[model samples]
Target: MKIEVNMTETKSNDSETITTTQQTSGAKNDSSKGPESIYTVPLLKLIKEAQQQHGLRHGDYQRYRTYCSSRLHRLRKVLHFPQGDRKGFKKREVTLDNLKDEKFVYLPLIQAERAWAYAMQLKQESNTEPRKKFHLVARLRKAVSHTIHLEYICQSPLCDARTKLEAQAYSAWMQGTLFFELQEWKQASEKLVLSQTIYEKLASALNEDEQILYKQRVEELNPNLRYCAYNIGDSSAQQDLLNMRSKGGKSELDALIAQTREKQAASLLEVTWRGRTVPVRLEKIRVFLLAYQGLDASLGKANDCDAKLSAYETILLDCKEAIQSLKEDLAAVAKTKVDLQSSQLGSQQYLLSYLTFLRATLTIDRNLVMVDVFQKNFAAYQSGESKKVAKPQEGVKLYEAMVQLSGELQQLQGMENDKKFQNDLELLTKVFKAFRCYYMALTCQGNRQWAEALALYQRAETYINQSEGKKLGDSEFTKYSRVGQDLAHLRSLVNSGKCAAHAQNILGVEDINAAMSGLSVRSKKVYAAPDLQIWRLAVYKLILYM
Candidate 1:
C-alpha cells in the first residue's frame, strides 16, 4: 500500500488559510500496516467523510470521539508507548524523539478528542455531584488547548481553517454549555452567540456538502442559545431563535416561553392606589396584592379556586410578619413624638389596615363560593343522583368564616376617612348578615324547626331591606330589594302553618268535601283562595282537622 499527502499554506494580513490533499491505496485485507495506520489517517477527516457519505448517523459526535480515542490508545500501546492516565499524557514525558515523528502529530488531536468526551460525561453526572462541574470545566479547557496545538501542526490552508474554526467554535460552545449548566445565563448567551456566528460564516464559505455539515452544527446550537436568551430575559432574541426552523416547524422554545409568561402573569400584580404606584420592594404587600389578583382570577374557574384560596392563606402569613415589623416601627415613631397626623408611620398603618381589609374581603368571598358549591352538590346528592357532595359541616365552617371576615373588615381602623372603603364595608356587612341569617334558616328548616326558620327568614329579609336604604346605588338597591321580597314570601310560608299542612299532604287531597267538612263556607273559600298569611293559616287548620 502507498499513501501520498500534500499540505499547502497561505498567509495574508487579513486571513490565514490552509489546504490539504491526500490519497490512500490499500486492499481490504491489508493488515501489514497494523494499528499505526490509524494515526496516518486524520480522525476528523475520517469522521467528516463518513458523515458526508451518510455512513455516520446524526448525534454520533461523542461516539466517534470515543472510538477515535480508543484507536489512538491502542496504536500507542502497539508501539510500546506509555498508556496515559485519564487526564492525558504528562507533558514532560513526551520526548523530543516522539515530536520529530509524523505519527506523534496526531497525539494532541486524540487527547483533545478524549478530553471533550470526558468533559461531556462529567457534565451529565455533575448535577448530582456539583463539585464535578469544576473538573468538567477544566477538562474542556484542556481540550481547547490540545486542539489549538493541533491547528499549529496541521497548517494546510483548508486544514488550518477547519481546525481553527472547530477549535474556537467548540471552545465557545463548551464554555457556553458550562455556564448554562451553572445558571450563568448572561455569559452563556454571549458565548453561544459567538459560536453561532462563527459556524454561520464558516458554513457560508463552504461547498454544498460542507455547508450541510455546518448547517446541522448550527442547528444544534440554536436551542441552547434560545434557552440562554429566555433565562436572561431577552425576549426579542428568544422569539427570533424560536421562529427559526429545526427538524420541523416551530421549536419547543416557543412553548417554553409561553409557559414562563403564564407563570409570571399568574404570580404578578401591578397595583396603583390613590394615584401612587406600589413599590415592589415591599415584599409582603406585593405578595398580598398578587394573591388578591389571583383570587379574583380564580373566581371564574370552579375547580381551581381551592388552590388559589390556599395561596391567599399563605400570603396572609407573610402579611402577619410584615404587620409586626410595621408595628415596631410605629412604636419607635411614637416615642419620638413625631407629628402623628402626616407621618410615614401613619401611612404604614393605613396601608396595613387596607391590606387587612383586602385579605378579609377575599376570605369572605372564597367562603361564600365554597358554601354555594357545597349547597349545589348537596342538592344534587339529595335528588338521588350520583354526585360528589362535600360534608354539610364544611358549608357551616365556610359560613362562619364569612361572618368572621366581615366583622374584621368592619372593625379595621382608618377606614372611616375613606368614603369608598366605608361604603363597601357597610354593604358587605349587610350582605354577610343576610347570608348568616339565610344559612341559619336553612339549618332550622333541616331540623324541622318551623318557628325558628320563620324567625331567621324574617331577620334576613329585614337585613336586605336595611341594606337598600344605606345609600346603596340604584343597581345594588334593586338587587337587594328583589332578594328581600323573596325572603319575605318564604317567611310567610313558614309562618302560615302551610309547612306543617304540606308535610301531612293535606293541601291538595282529592276528597275535598270531606277535607273541608269541619270548616265554614268562608273557610272553604279561604282554602280555595289563600292570598294572605291569615287566610292560609285558616285553611291550614281546617284541612288539618278534616
Candidate 2:
C-alpha cells in the first residue's frame, strides 16, 4: 500500500487544501530482493498499548503529545539519529538503509502520534478560535505524511505481513480522520471503510485477548463512517447510528457516544426504575441515570468480589456527583422562588430518594463483599498456610456495617412500601446476622470460651439455614450458596467444640487445674487455701463416727 499527498488551492476555511490518495492493492517494493530478514514490529499493538499507557486512555491529547515527544527524543538519542543541534534545524528522513532495527520503525510512528495529538489538542480549541483550524489541518497533514512514510518503510521484505498490514491500516485511518474533519464525505467514507475492513480482518484472525484493540478501533470508526455516509446522502445512516448506539459496550468511546446522543435528545427525560417512570429534568442527572444502566453489565464482567466492588465504587462516585449537581439545581430554583407544581416537586424528591436508596444498597453490597474477603482471609489463616492474618473481630465489624447499611437502605423514603426491596433487605439482614454470629463464635473460641463459642456457632447455623430456605434471586443465590459452604464448615467445628466442652464438664479436674494455672501464687493462696475450722469439724465428726 502507498499513499500520495497532493496540495491544492481551495477557498474553504481559508486554509491550504490537502488531498490524500492511496494505492490499496499491491505495494510495489522497488528495493532489491534483499535478505529475507525476520525483522518485525507489531505496529497496531504497540501504538494502542502506548496510547493506553499515555493520556489517550482518558482523552487528554496534550498529555499524550508530550509523552510522544519525549519518547521520540529518547529513541533518537539511543539510535544516534538526532535531527539537528540547537543552532540550525536539519530534517532527518528515515530510509530503507537506516531500518536496521525494529526500533527504527518507532521513530515515524511516534512522530505521527505526536503530530496527531497536537492536531486533536488544536481541534478542541478550534471551536473558540477559528484560526486554529488552519494549524489543526497542518498538523494532521504532517501526521498523514509520517504515516505514509511509515507504511512505505514497512513494505520492505524485512518486515512481516502483520507489520505491513497494520501500517497500511494506520495510514488509512489517519487519512480518513483528516478527510472526516474536512467534511470530504466521499473521501472520508472510502478511507474509513478500507481501514474498518482491514481491522475487522485482523481481529477475526487473532485470539480473543488480541482482538480487543482491533475490534475497539472498528467500533470507534463506526460513528465517523455513519456521519460521513449521512453527509454523502445515505438513507440508512440514521438507522445505522441508532443501532450502534443500542449495541453499546463499556468502552470509553461508547460512553462518550451515548452521552453525546443523550444530551442531543434532551426531551427524552424520563427514567424508569422498578416499574415506575420518574421525570429526571436535570440533564446531568438524566445522563448519569442512562450510564448507570450499564452498571450491572460492568459488574457482571468482573470475575471476582474485589473487581465488582471496585466497579461499584466508580459508579457510586458518579452517583454522588449527580446527586450533588441535582441538589445545586434545586437550591437555585428554591432561591428564585419559582413555585414548582406539587407533582413535579414530588417527582424530583422521589428521584432524590431513589438515588439515595441506590447508593445505600450498593454500599451494603460493598460491605458484604468486604465481609466475604475478611472471612476468607481469616479462614485461610485458620487453615495455617496463608501468611496474611485477618482476625475474626474484623469480620464481625464488617458484618455489623452491612447490617446497618441494609437497614438504612430499607428505611429510605422511596423504599417504605417496596415489597421486593424490603424482602431483599430482610434476607440480607439475616445473612449479615449469620456471618456476624459465625465471626463472633470464632472470637469466643479464640478466647477459650468453648461453651459460648458452641452456642454462637449453633445460632449461626440456624440463621444460615433460615436464609437458605428463603426464595433467592440469582445474585442472592450466589451469595447464599457461599454462605452455605461456610456454615457447613462451621458445623463441624461447632460439633468438635461441643464435644470438648462436654468432656471438660465431665472431667472437671482438668478444667480446675487449667483455670488455677492461669492465676498468680498470691491469688491461689487467697482463693484456694483450705479453711482450718471446716477441716477440724470434718476430722472430729469422722473420729466420732469411727
Candidate 3:
C-alpha cells in the first residue's frame, strides 16, 4: 500500500502551523492527522524492504547507495506538489525554475540528502578519482546554496526554527566534509566552524532527543575541525579542539594532541630567524615536519642504507621546492608593493638557506656513516688491522656537495654581515675542509704516497687549528682542544709515514731521530701501530745509517 504525504508549514509573528495532506492508494486518510500517525509505518516498511533487498553488510556501499536512492524517491513522491499538467511534465526536466514555480517546500532538503548520499558513495570509493570527488563537492555546494535560499524564503516558522536551521547546519557541515576530502583545509576549517556555531544555536530550540542528536553531531565535527586547523597551522584553534573533552576517553586524540604540541614547540624554535620575527609560512613548516618524520621513519630501516639515502634525498628535494616557492611568493609581493621591507625578505631567504643547509648536513651525515661502515668492513676483511684501502668515492662527492652548498649560503647578501650567520658559515667551512683533507690523506696513505699524505694531513691540521680559533664559549674551547689533540695524533701518523718512506731510502740517523723526537715530544700518549711501525722503521733506518 503506497501513500503520498504532503506537508506545508506557515508561520505568523507569534505562532507556527503545519498542515498535512495525504493521498493513499487504498483509502484517503483523515486530513487533520499529523504525519507521524499516517506516514511512519509506511516509511519504516519501505526501509525494511530496502534492507532486505540489499544485504546489511558493513562495507556494502552499493547496497547503501541503492537504499538512499529509493528513500529519496519515496520522499520526493510524498512531498512533491503538482503545479502544472503532469501529462507534459517529465521528472528529468525539473529545473530550478520549475522548482520555484511549483513551490516545492521540501525540494532543497531532498536535494541535500541526494547530494549527501552521492558524496558518501564517492568517499567510500577511495582516493583514486579526485576529479569525481571534486565534482561531487560542487554538487554539495549547490545543495548548500539551496538550503540557504530555503532558510530565507520559506515562510514556515516550523521550517525556520527547526527544519531550516537544521538543513543549513547539515549542509554547511557536509560542505566542510567535502572540502576536507578534497584537501582544501582552510575552507574546510571555516565551514566546519560555521556549522558548529549554527548547531550550538539550534540546540536550544530542539527537544531532549533532538538536542542529544545535535550534541553528537557537534562532537563528530571536532576531529575534522582539529585536523583542518592543524594542517592550516591554526595552533590556537587546534589547541581549543584538543582541550575539548570527549565523552569516551580517546587515547588516539590524546596522542595526537601531544604530537602536535611537540611539532608546535619545534616550529616555534624556528619562528625567529636571525633575531627577526618572520611571518609563519605553512608550506615551510610542513616541509620541516615531513623531513623530521621521514628521518624518524628512515631510522627504523637501519638495515636498508639505500632506502635511508633515498628518504634523505626526497626530503632535500622537498626543501628545495619549498625554497623556490618562498622565492616566488616574495617576488610576487615585491612587484605590487613599493615600500617593501627588505629585512623581512632577507630573513625569509636566510630561513630557506638554513633549511637547505640542514638537508645538506644530513647528506653529509649519511656519507660519514657510509664511510664508517665501509672502513669497518674493509678493516674486518683484512684480518683485524687497518689497511690503506681505497676509500668510498661517495664520501668525497658528498663533501664536495656540502662545500658547494655552504659556499652558496655564504654568498647570500648580508650573510657576512650577520655575525651569527658568518660564524656558522665559517665553522661549517672549516669542518668540511678538515674532513675533505683527512679523507684525502687517508687515500694518499693507502696509495703509498707518503709526501702527498703528509701534505694533506698538515692541511687538515691547519683547518682544525683555524676551527679552534673560532670557538665562542668555554665548552666550545674544550671541544676544540680535543680536536687539537686528534690533530696531534694525525701529525704522528704523518711522521710515521715519512719515517717508513725514509727507511726505504738512504737517510741519516740524525734526520730519523729528529723526526721521532719531534713526534714523541708533541704528545706523551702512545700512538697506534702505524705510528709505532714508523718509529721502529726510523730506528732501523738509524741503525743502517749508523
Candidate 4:
C-alpha cells in the first residue's frame, strides 16, 4: 500500500520547490512512496495526480496552487525575518513541496497517518466504530507494516494474532475510561481482558508532541504488563516474495491460496460479499490491481513531464550562480585602487560594464540586483568619474560633468530622491543667478524692468535652503549673502543710471534714465520675450563693447 501526499503547485512555488512522481512497473511502486522521491518526477505530474485522486478540476487545482503559493512565499519571508509582525506565518500550511526546507514536514504527516491507522485497527474487533476516507491510511499501512515485519519471524502467526492484540488494546483503553467514570475496576477489567496486547505499542513514529500524548495514554492503562504473549513475526514472508520476483514467479500467489482456503472453510456460499472489510496488508499486486485504472493510464504520460522539469531546475540554478559571480567581480574593482587618474578611469569604465551586466541580469531573468545597485549609487551622490575627467583651466570640465550628470539624473525615471543631483543643482543655480544679475545691471543700468531681473535672482535662492544640509562650509551663510550684494549693486546701478552726480556725480539724471531705459526697451523689442535668456545675451553684448 502507498500513501498520497495531496498538495497544490502554489504550495510548491511558495516553498521554492518542484515535485513530480512516476510509477515503475514490477509488482508496482506505491503512490504513497512519492513524497520523498517527487523531486525526481515532473512538477506537473504530481499536480495532475492530485486532481484525479481528489477529482479536482483545472480551475480548482489552479486556485489551490495559488493559495499554496501565496502561503509558501509569505511564510518563507516571515521565517527569514521572524522579528516582525506577520503572525499569519503561524497558520501557514505544510506540504510535501515545502517540506524539503521546512524543519520537519514528514513527522506531522506520519503522525496523521498513524492516528488514522490506529483508529481503524481498534474498529476491527466488535467494540469500536471504524473511520473511512482518511488521507494517510495508505502511508501508515505501508510504513507500519515495514516496521512490524522487521521485528517478526512468522508472518501468519503474528498476522493472525494481530486482531486479538488490537481487541485487547481497545478493551484496556475503554476499561480504563469506564473505571474513571463509574468507579468500578471489575467492569473495567472485563473490558481490559478484551484488549489484544497487554500493552499497545507507543506511537513513537509520530511527532514529538503526539508521541508525548501517546506515552501518557499507554502508561495510564498498561503499566507492568507484557505486550508479546504470542511471538511477533519476521520478514521471512517478505524475503520469499523478493525471491519469487527474482525467479520470475508470481509473488502474490501464496496470498491467493490462503484467502481461497479460508473462504472454503467458512463456506463461501453463505458469505456476505458486501460486509465491511477489515484493513489488511495486501501484496503490491493486490494494491495495484485494486487501485483505479486511471493511475496506470496517467503513469505513461506523466513520466516524461517529470524528466523535463528536472532539467529546467538545473538550468535555473546555473543562471543564478553565474549572475552572482559577475557582481562579485565588480565589487572587487571598487576596492584597492590607488592612482586616481588610471585607477579611477578604470573604475568608471567598469561601472558602465557593471551597469550593462546588471540590466542584463534584470531583464533577461528579472533578478533585482540592479535595483539595489541603482538606489545605492544614485543616493550616495558620488561622481567617481571625476578622477578620470580631463583636467582643464581650474575645474571647468569638472563643473560641466556635474551639470551633465544633473541633467541625466533628472531624466531618469523614479529618481525623485536623488540627493546628489539636488546638491549640484543648488550650487550651480546660485552661480548662474549671480552672473545673470550682474549682466543685467551692466547692460540695463537704468531699465524699467530691472525689477524682473532682481526677482529672478531672489527666486534662485530657494534651491539654497538645502545647502545648509550638505554642510559645505561654516561661512555658508556669508557665502550666500555675497549673492545679495549683487542685488544691492544692481540697485545702485539703477540709481546712478538716472543721476550723473551718482555716476560721475548725477548731472544729467533724467537723460541717463531715458537713454538706459530706451536701450532696454530696444533690446526687449529685438528679443521678443522679457526674460533672462534675452537679458543675458544683451548684457554679454554690452560687455564685449566695453
Candidate 5:
C-alpha cells in the first residue's frame, strides 16, 4: 500500500508556520531539499530510525514508542483531512502483528516484542462490520461538519450570484423616486428609466410574484413621469403668486389659466399595464397645472384654487393619518394569537411544513422574500434605505417564523392524539425544502431592495397562490397590509420626507405579524375584523421615537 503524506497539516497553535506538503510521486529529491516528507519508510531507514529511537531488545519502552508513532500517524491522517474530497481518499493502514497475543498485541519486529493491538483496534461487538467498528461517533462528527457546510451553501445561492445586482437596481429605482419627489427632473427621469431597465432584467430572472412586484413598481414610477409637467405648473403658480398678478389680472392671465386647465385636464395621469389602464391621482399637481395655464385668473379664481389645494392637502394628510392608524390596528391583531385545535393544526402544520421544506430546498431563508420582492416590482413598495428606516425582517434573512413551527411539531410528535399533526409535520419537511428561493426574491424587494425584492416576492406570492389561494381572507390581507403600510410609512419618514416619526416598536409589529400569521383558519375567521388605523395609533401612542 502507498501512503500520501500531506505535509500541510500545521499543528493547531502553529497553524501559520507549519503546513503539509505531499512528496511528489516517484521522485528522489535531495534529503535536505527543504524538509522532505517521509512515508512508508524504506526498510533500511526504518530499522535505523527505530534503533536510534529505542533500544529494541529492552523493555516496554520500545512497544510504547511504536504504538505512539502508529497511533499518531493514524490520528493525524483521520482528523486533518485535506479539503474538497467529496469522495474522500483513504490512507494506508498500518500492518503489524502481535508479539504476545494475550492481554496485548505486539509487532513482529524485535523492537516491540510485547506490543498490544487490542487497545489500538477500535471496539465493537463481534457482529459489527470492521468499518462499523470504526466509531460512529467519528462518522457523525464528520457528517455534522459536512451538513453545516452544505447548509451554508444551500442557504444563499442568490446572494452569491445576484445580491449586488438586485440591490443596485432597487437603489437606482429609489434614487429615481427620491429625485422625482425632490423635483430633480432630469436625474429623476434618468434614474426611473434605468430603474425600469434593471427591473426588466430582474423580472426575467424572477418568478411570478416577483414579476408582479416589478409591474407594481413600474406602475408607481409611470405616474411619476408626469411629475415634470406638474413641477412646471408649480413654477408657474409660484411665479404668478409672487408677482401678485391676480391683484391686477383677471384680463390676460385669465385666458392663460383656462388654456392651462384644459390641457392639464386633457392630459390626465394614467398608468398602462398589459394594455389596461390603472387610475392614479395627479391631484397633487392638477391644480397647479391648471392655474399655470391661467384658467383661473381672477383673485376669486386664485382663491378657489388655493382653497382646493389646501383642502386636497388636508385630505392627503388625513389619508396618511388614517393609513398610520390602520397600521396600528393590524399590529394589535398580529400580537393576539388564535390557536388551532389538533385537527385545524394538522392542516396548517402541513402547509407550514410544505412551505418550510420548499423554502429549504429552494434555498431561501423564508417565504416573505416573495412578498417583499413582488411589492417592489409593482412599485407598491420599496426596499429599506438606511438605519433610520426599518425594513421587512421576515423570511429571506432567516425563516425564523417557519422554524418556530418545529417546536409545535415536536410537541405534536409526543402526543398520542396528534396523528394528523405528525403527518402534517412530515409533509411540511418535504415542501419547505423548496421555499428558500422564493424567500430570497421576497427579501430582495423589501426594505427598498426592489430588484431582488420583486423577484423574491413573485416566487413567494406564487407559492401562496398555489398553496392557499383566495382562502387568505381579511385577516391575512389585513395582516399583510398593516405591515406593508407601516413599513412604507416608516421608510418614507426616515429621511424626513413624508411619514416622519413612524412607529418605534419594530419588533412589536414583527411579533404581532408572527402571532397573527399562525392563527388557525377557523380561529382567524373567528377573530374580530382587524383595524389597522387603531393598531397604528396604538403603536404611535406607545412609541417613544422622535
Candidate 6:
C-alpha cells in the first residue's frame, strides 16, 4: 500500500539540517556535507570590555543591565531579526538552525548579561526588601538558562574552537554563581575552579596587555574559591585570606567578611603556633580573634587615614581587654596550683604568648600603615606629583615605633629559640633602623642641615648593608624584595642629594667670599694713609672758598 523510498539524512551549510534522499528508481542521488567550522568570535574579550565600559567596572549592575537591553535591541535591529512590533511583543530564539551569521551568537550573550545584571541589581536591593531575594535567584536562574543555550549553539559544527571554549567557561561561571547563591558549596567550587582554570590557560597564551583582563578575572575568582573552600571546611582558607589581604585587595572582599566571621565563629576552635596546638577555651579571646580576621576588610572600607586608624585603635582596645581577661584567668589558674605537665596549663601559657605576639604584631602593623602613608606623601612631594609638604619627621616616629615592636617580638618566649623568627625579626630591626635614619636625613635635608643629613645618610647605608648581608631563602627574599628595592632606590636618592647639597654649599661659600672681598677693598681704600695729600688739597680748596 506504500511506495518503497530510500532516504538519506545529511547536513548542509545553507540550511539548519538539510536532508538528501535517494531512491532506487530515481534517476540520480544527492548527498550534503556539514557546515565548515570557520566562524571565530572573541566572545569573552568583547563582552568583558563592553561590560567594563558600560557599568560593571564601577559595580553598577542596574546601569549595565540597561546597557545590555539597548545593545540587544540594536543587534536585533541590525540583523533584521526583530521578533515583533513595539506594541505587540513576541519571543524569538537563536539556534544553530536559525543562525546565519557569526554576530547571531551575541543574542544569547546579551540575554544572559541582562539577566545576570538584573540579579546583581536585585542583590543590592535585597537587603532592604528581603522578598527581592526570590527575584534575584529567579533572575540568576534565567541567566544560567541563557548561558546553557549559548553553549549549545556554540557546540555546532559552524563554531570555532575559541568560541566553544569561551562558551563553556562562561556557562560554568554562570552555573557557579547560581550555585554559590544557593549555598551549594561543593558544586559552586567545582564549576568556579573549572572557569578559573580555563581563564588561566587563556591568560598564559595572551600578550601582556591582553592577558591583564583574563588574569584579573582569575583573581576575582580567588575570593569566591576561598569562601567556598571555607564553607566546605578547608583548613587553608584562612591562610588564603591573609595572603590576599597582604596584597592590598581587601576592599573587594567587604561582602565576604560578615558571612566569613559568622561561619568562623563556630568553625575556629583552636590556635596553632610554633608547631603546637592550643584550644581556644575563652569566648572573649575567640571573639577577639574573629574580629581580627576582619581587620583588612574593615579598614579597607574606611574613607580616609584617620578612619582606618580609628578602626585599628578600636581593635587594639579589644586586644587589650582580651589580654586583661586572659591574665585574670591565668592568675586564677595559678592559685589552683595547676600542674605544668597538664595540657590545659600549657595551652593557657601558649595562648598568652600567642596573644602577646598578636598584640605586638598589630601595633607594628598600625605603625607601619602610618609609615606607609607618610612615605607616600614624601615620595609624591619628591617626585613633584603632589603639592603637599613632605613630613619625614612623622615617618621617623613611626619607624621608631616599629623598631620597638620588633624588639618586643624578638623577646617572645617561643620566638627566642625560633631561628627563622629571630632572623626575620633581626632583618626587620635593621630595615626599620635604616628607614629611621633615612627619614631623619630627609628631615635634616629639609632644614638645610647638610652635614647632619649627610651623616644620617651614611648611617642608613650602614644599616641597609647589615640587613642585606644575612642570607634568605627564596620565599623570604621575595617577601623582603620590595623594601630592598626601596632601600636601593633610597641609596640613589641619597647620592644625588649629597651631590646637590655639596654644590649648594660651595655656591654659598663663593657668594659670601665675593661679598666680603668687595667690602674689604672699599674699607682699605677709605682708610689708606696715601689719601692725606688729597685731604690737604681739599682743605686748601675749602680755605679759598671761605
- Candidate 6 lDDT over 9-87, as tens digits, reads 3435323232211211122234322222356777788888888899988899989999999999999998889988879
By TM-score, the better pick of 1 and 6 is: 6
- In order, candidate lDDTs are 0.57, 0.74, 0.56, 0.35, 0.39, 0.77
lDDT per residue, candidate 3, 391-479, as tens digits? 53544565667677667766765455766665666676676677677667667766766667667767876776776545434231232
Q: After superposition, how far is residue 157 of candidate 3 from its true place, in Å?
A: 52
For model 1, state the Cα shift of residue 394 in Å: 3.1
lDDT string for model 1 (1-546, tens) is: 223232233345212111111111122344332222222333335445644443125544556566767767775765556666688865433333344334555566667766776777676688699999889888877776776566555553323355566556655776676677667989888888888888788889878966886787677777777767777887776445433322243434444434444444454544544544443334445544544444444434424646545545644665566566656766887798766355233555666676665556556545654665676786787685846764445655675676677567666775456566556556756666765676676666667666666677677667767665454443312323433334454445334433453432333343355446657855554244335445655776788579
Clash number for each model: 7, 0, 0, 27, 92, 0
What ranges in model 4 sit over 4 Å off? Answer: 1-405, 413-546
Top TM-score hit: 2
| Worst ten in a row by lDDT for model 5 | 98-107
Which candidate order results from sorting by TM-score in descending order? 2, 6, 1, 3, 5, 4
lDDT tens digits, residues 1-546, model 5?
222334456667443222221122223343222232222212223333454455433433435456545744454445442233569765422121210111111111211211212212222232355664345334333323332332232223212334334434444554554455345877877867776776667667778855766665554554344444344555544444323333333333443433445455557554332233444233423334234234224323534434434433433343344334434543565589655455433332332333232223222222343434433543433433322432344333344444444335445322335455444444343233224444454344335444444444444444333333122132212323333223333322222321121222343455467678778966654334357546865776566355
For all predicted structures, in order, the TM-scores are 0.45, 0.55, 0.42, 0.15, 0.18, 0.52
* Structure candidate 1, residue pairs in collision: 17-157, 18-156, 18-157, 18-158, 19-156, 19-157, 19-158
Sort the candidates on lDDT, descending order: 6, 2, 1, 3, 5, 4
The better candidate by lDDT, 3 or 4, is 3
Between prediction 1 and prediction 6, the one with superior lDDT is: 6
Better of 2 and 4 by TM-score: 2
Tell me, by lDDT, which candidate is best. Answer: 6
